[model samples]
Target: MKTSSPNTLTEKLKSRVVLIALFVGSMWAVFFLSVALPFLHLNEHGVVPRSLDGLQGILFAPWLHASVGHIAANTSGLVVLGWLCTWPNIAGFWRATIGAMLGAGLCAWLFGAPYSVHIGASGLVFGYAGHLVARGYYTRNLVSILVALVVVSSYGLSLLFGVLPIYPDVSWQSHVGGVLGGVLAARAGAGAANRVRVR
Candidate 1:
């Protein structure tokens, strides 16, 4: 059986790291650009509940933020959880991200206050966490289970509280929707893997 050499594995790891860095870098870039050009009003692009114009936020909201503190709060979660999603394969990472974005955006639009605009990568961060945890449940593998346990131990409280509507400024709807999306993605991925194995 031919296997990847050490150098190849190292290269693959480096590539994945670069991908994560680029993604996070893009978020920072957007934040700085929005700050520098306030006239652009980039934040206005965020999900505006039930408004026809706000539908665009489904694709743009995850890339927008209100302030440095807002983006900073989400940065660490995105970096750590995003890196975790890249494991086993890179396709999984995209699945989680896209799923999270759509789910979170839709939920915020559906459930958010009538006049409020929801923005932030917190939804995606929550989505990554949800994906990792659900992947363990669906895959029933030792590595996945270990990863899930780590997530639970580290983020259990946040995950629980984040979905509740206790904080007026926070979008619990997005977090809940992101988690649901991540779980569904995990289920879909597991089903596809099972079919592939069966064939």
Candidate 2:
């Protein structure tokens, strides 16, 4: 069997790290640009409840933020949880991200307060947590199970409270939708893997 050489492994790791950095860097870039050009009013592009014009937010909301504190809070979760999702394969990370974005954005659009603009990456963070936990349940693998345990231990409270409407200005709808999307993505990915193995 061919095995990856030390250099090859190092290169692959570096690539993955660079990719994650680029992803996070883009978010920071958008935030900084928005701050520098307030006339752009990027926040207005966020999900607006039940409005035709707001539908665009499903694709844009995750990249937009209302404030520095908002993005700062999401940055840690994205770096950590996003990195975790890359385990085993990078495709899983993209799948989880797309699923989370769609789920979170749609939920925020459908249920957000009238005329309120919902923005931030919190939904993606929640989606990553959901994907990790659900991947364990669906795959029943040791690595996945351990990762899920770690996620639950570290983020169980946030997952629980984030989906609740107790916090004013918080998008609990997006949180709930993100988890649903993540779980669905995990299940679909597991099923595809299973089919491939059976062949």
Q: Indicate which candidate wins on TM-score.
A: 1
* Inter-residue clash pairs, candidate 1: none
Instruction: State model 2's lDDT.
Output: 0.92
- Sequence-dependent TM-score of model 2: 0.96
Question: What TM-score fits each model?
Answer: 0.97, 0.96
Please give the TM-score that candidate 1 achieves against the real structure.
0.97
lDDT per residue (tens digit) for residues 1-199 in model 1:
9999999999889989999999989989999999999999999999999999998988888889988999999999999999999988999999999989988999999999998999999999899999999999999989999999999999999999999999989999999989988988889889989999999
What C-alpha lDDT values do all the predictions have?
0.93, 0.92
**What is candidate 2's lDDT per residue for 113-145, written digit by digit as tens?**
999888888999999999999999999999999
Instruction: Output the number of the lDDT-best candidate.
Output: 1
Return the clash pairs for model 2, or none. none
